[model samples]
Target: MAKRLSLLLLRVSLGGLLLVWGVNKVVNIDHSMAIAENFYFGLLAAETWLPVAGVVQMAVGLLIIAGFARRWVYPIQLLLNGVSLAAVIASVIDPWGWFLEGTNALFYPSLIIFAGSLVVMAFADQDQLALDARKAPAPVSWKARRDCGQ
Candidate 1:
């Protein structure tokens, strides 16, 4: 029960973070473009693609929150968050700007989010609260497999 609840909380929080960022990209495209320019080496800055990307991200976020299709959605979320973490690694390493010039304490949370996504991916099979859990086959004990002869 505790594990399920913990996974549910992590999933909802990470999904909510993605959803909010997606909405920001769609509603405040200029801001999104500026972030891309500043952190992502100007990638994802095309005005035409911003809203479309936002919609796609929103879908992925919703699927994550619902714990549906985790096999695919978890990887997508992990990759996206991984990229985000990479973009802000400097900030995470030097949030106070002790040595890094452009570091900001605000971006440090990306590290935590990335770690949470990793946790979700690693323990996905144990997430009984996931919508697809019912569809997954029960795990076979090692003893049972041994008894079955290879």
Candidate 2:
């Protein structure tokens, strides 16, 4: 029960973070473009694709929050977060700018977000609070399987 609750909290928090960022990308194009230019090599025609990426990210975030289609959503979330993390790896490694010029203290949270996404994906089956959990078939015990002589 504790495990389930913890996973639920992590899932919701991560989803919420993604949703907010996605919305920001759509609503504040200039800021999103700045971030892309600074962190993502201008994102290759970002003016055209940023908002589209934002919409897709928003959908993935919603699915993650609802714990729906976790098998697909979890991996998508992982990939998205992984890319973001990779972009900020310098800040994560030297957030104080001790040796890196572009490092920022604020970007360190990307590490935590990435870790949380990994945890959610690793424990997807244990998240009983997820919407899909209720629909999942119960696991058969070893005794039952043996009795059936499979």
Candidate 3:
């Protein structure tokens, strides 16, 4: 019971953070684009795709919180985070002034949230408080039922 509860809490917390970040993309689009600038390249500009990205992120977050399909959703989320983290890392060639310039505060918090996502992925199997928890009824034996008179 405790394990299930802890797993649920972690899932909820991680989902909530993603939800906020996703929604923030839509609500404060310019800020989002600024952050997404790190990922921008070729035709993948934030201005052209941030809203769609926001929707996908928000949906993924909702599914995580609702525990719809932890096996699938958790992995998808990990991939998403991995891509974002890679973009951040790829963009920053040096950290000489990442702190003094005040970028660490944002980047580090994102790294922590990414860490939380990792924890959620690890415990996804123990999830109990979720839509997917509805177990199907066991197969009923017709012979046994008839012998018992309905």
Give the per-residue lDDT digits (tens) of candidate 3, residues 1-150. Answer: 898888888788877767887898778888887766645452334565777778888988899999897778888788877766665652243344544442333454456666778987776655667778765577779998899998
Q: TM-score for each prediction? A: 0.89, 0.88, 0.69
Residue 135's C-alpha lDDT in candidate 2? 50
Candidate 1 deviates by what RMSD? 2.9
Please list the residue runs of candidate 2 whose C-alpha ends up more than 4 Å from where it truly belongs after superposition.
134-150
Pairs with steric clashes in candidate 1: none
Relative to the unseen true structure, what is the C-alpha lDDT of residue 99 in candidate 3, on a scale of 0 to 100? Answer: 44
Error of 1 at 139 (Å): 6.9
lDDT of 1 by residue, 1-150 (tens): 889899999999999888998998899999999999999999889898888889989999999999999999999999999999999999999999999998999999999999999999999888888788765677999999999996
Candidate 3, residue 41: how far the Cα is off, in Å: 5.1
- The prediction achieving the highest lDDT against the true structure is 1
For model 3, state the Cα shift of residue 132 in Å: 0.8
Q: Write one digit per residue (lDDT tens) for candidate 2, span 5-90.
A: 89999999998888998898899888999988887888843777889988888999999999999999888888888989999999
What clash pairs does model 2 have?
Answer: none
